[model samples]
Target: MTWGRARCALLAIPIRPNIRGRAVMAYDDNNRGLLLALKYGDKMEGVSTMARWMARAGRDILTDTHIIVPVPLHRWRLLSRRYNQSAVLANRLAELTGRLAIPDLMVRVRAT
Candidate 1:
């Protein structure tokens, strides 16, 4: 996956659960579920759903690649948000695919 000033992209390799040359890499808010629980508070069902999709879309890539690279957020953004949403999704994806999710491969280059 790659991220630029305003864009984030994922490289999808064709394999099972997909027959087309291209596939979706990221999840938009449109395709998510909201689960409200008294004990667990608000939960994003989208996480698991997206994870399954990621695992299916990248099944072939996972077998060939050694690591999963998730785009990093700026420290300021991370602090404000308290989490790197991409990293969370990436972790779920790696877990679903049974692959090692490596978040340190790419560093967030601060704008200088």
Candidate 2:
């Protein structure tokens, strides 16, 4: 599906540095589980939940954001797992905030 196509294909990986930067994350309390679930546990159900939390955290800047870009997965990882957590997160977040998910802006020179 086109939902996580960018992430599925493997390319760029977006890293959020701060709230004032390109991305805003939700909850700093014990996020390893949540991230792991989304990344490797087949927790697609949490996309909406995560998007809601992300939206809440980024409410102040949602208006400033035009496109929600997902951090792409490495080709090898995607080939093996067949999914990308960041892709779904970005798409859901964009849908919730009425923005667009731009998956091609940041191109990766090499997979990390």
Best candidate according to TM-score: 2
- The sequence of per-residue lDDT tens digits that candidate 1 reaches over residues 1-112 is 3222323226444322212222554334643323212113334457778678767776666667656667787787667556666777778887877778877656787932
Candidate 1 off by > 4 Å: 1-22, 25-43
The C-alpha lDDT values of all candidates are 0.59, 0.73
- Measured by lDDT, the strongest candidate is 2
User: How good is model 1 by TM-score?
Assistant: 0.60
Q: Candidate 2's residue-wise lDDT over 1-112, tens digit each?
A: 2333334335465444223533445556777777788889987877898788889887887877777777777778777777877888888888888999976555554677
Ten residues in sequence with the least summed lDDT for candidate 1: 32-41
Count clashing residue pairs in model 2: 0
Model 1, residue pairs in steric clash: none
Q: Distance (Å) between predicted and true CA of 74, model 1? A: 0.8
